[model samples]
Target: MPRIIVAEIDSAEQRAVAVDVWRAANAARRRTATEARIRRIQEKLDTAELALLAHYGPRPAGMLVAETYHVDGVPLPGYGHLSMVFVDPAVWGSHVGTEMIRDLQSRGWEGLSVWTRTDNRRAQRLYERTGFTDTSNRSTLRDGEEIMQLAWSLSET
Candidate 1:
């Protein structure tokens, strides 16, 4: 059986693992950022974010970077915005991605949102299954790829 571990990534080793996941997740879809950018992002994580890792046994198979921030002058509590989520290609079908989302939701992420390329049907399907709904919001990355954002709110009930 596969095991999922949600560690608050802190040490250099864990951060390196996160970098690897970041590369794997964005491979073939977007241009990998430079070391400086990765460092900047990691700095953000180290400061006010909670980073989660999904472990398949002893190896870190996937990870998520989430942080809470206000939007449009509204203070959304426990609004976890997933900045990056990556599962190793070798373990793509092992349900790590789903497990991460479900686990985080269960841990009290009242609202969540993620953006994926319109061409990435697989990810879209996974997000939909995780209760995210399509929104009209669209984002353009630095490399010119158009991404659509999907969001899930626990307040509906």
Candidate 2:
């Protein structure tokens, strides 16, 4: 069985694991896993309200980042923004992502919101299956990738 651990986001070991998982999961769609990019991710993790790393025995398998504040341009209250969730491609169909979201929901958030690339249908399906609904709002990242916002009401859980 896999277990989740509260990550010390600023630690070198955790950061390296995060960057490795991210690169392995999204290398095709993202730029090379440069140190600068990993540093930026560490910065975000430092400010996040919650950061978790999932492990299957001794191997890192996934990560989740969440914040109490709403996502940019979103006006919702009592909602936690799920800033990031990434699972190793080797475990893509192993319920790792679902476990991460459930862990977040168990944190007492009234609701959860996330922004995902519009072209990432697999991620969309996963979120939808986990009870997130499309808010129909869209935004463009600095890299010009279009993103859609989705929200889940924890009250219904």
Candidate 3:
């Protein structure tokens, strides 16, 4: 693998790359509504506090979207919440996510938090390697009761 470079996604074209990455990453899941998923991700991007894309060599390999960290609807000061994160399955085990997390850490913040599917042990390990800890807070996604796990990381930035 080539170097991982993280940058702000700047155009509709870049957003499309993000959508592609999401679809490819979740291909094994029981999801099929590509149009709806794209729309939903776009809506979230429109409001995201920060949206990033990671490139492995010249190909977009990952997407991360974060906003104000919140608990019980209250914003957590100096913290960012990752609402969406995905990496192209082709690049699994490649540290595209580690690069994205490094980018986030460079941004001045007290801490960052993210929610991952409980069954996604791969993502959990990545977060743990990047200094995130399980926060013991869990929730169901908008469409179902599939468990989601929360992890928090304090940034050296």
Candidate 4:
């Protein structure tokens, strides 16, 4: 089996690889990247407090993006919001997403939260396997798709 390497996206090479992975992984959103969506992905990567790339062997196959977990402009202590966890479609079943989530878990966070489209069962399964639970919290996206928040359980950490 090829090794999985996870690291901070710290250079132009790393950022480029991460973006490429994001491009290929946009299917996670159940759509291809429209020009506008591509732009939005770039914008998010630029602004995210932390960006990480995961390599399955030599290929950058996953990217994880995080920002301070906050509400109403107030930051939550020891908490983080994972804005994105993308695995290239080529590596869809390879546990790259699990490795990315575990990287965050190893950071000693009090909690981490992520939102997934309500209908994205594959992602929900990954989250569940990696120890995140549905908070029963929900919201509607701009496109009218519903999403639910999943929170990491302290006991699991």
Question: Each candidate's lDDT (Cα)?
Answer: 0.78, 0.79, 0.82, 0.87
Order candidates by lDDT, high to low: 4, 3, 2, 1
lDDT of 4 by residue, 1-157 (tens): 8899998887767776778888776755567678887878777887778898998999889999987798899999888899988899888889999999888888867889999999989899999989999999999999999999999956665
Per-model TM against the reference: 0.84, 0.83, 0.87, 0.92
List where candidate 4 sits over 4 angstroms from the true fold.
27-30
List candidate 2 segments past 4 Å from native.
1-12, 28-30, 71-77
Tell me the spans in candidate 3 whose CA falls farther than 4 Å from its real position: 142-148, 155-157
Expressed as tens digits, the lDDT of each residue in 8-126 for candidate 3 is 87787888888888888878565685777679988776666789999999988999997888879998888887788898988888999988987887787678887777888888888
Q: Write the candidate numbers in order of decreasing TM-score.
A: 4, 3, 1, 2
Q: Which pairs clash in model 1?
A: none
TM-score of 4: 0.92
Q: lDDT score, residue 29, model 4?
A: 51
Candidate 2, which ten residues in sequence have the lowest lDDT sum?
A: 1-10
Q: Which candidate's lDDT is highest?
A: 4
Per-residue C-alpha lDDT of model 1 across residues 116-150, encoded as one tens digit per residue: 88878878887887899999799888778789999
Winner by TM-score between candidate 3 and candidate 2: 3
How many clashing pairs per prediction, in order? 0, 0, 0, 0
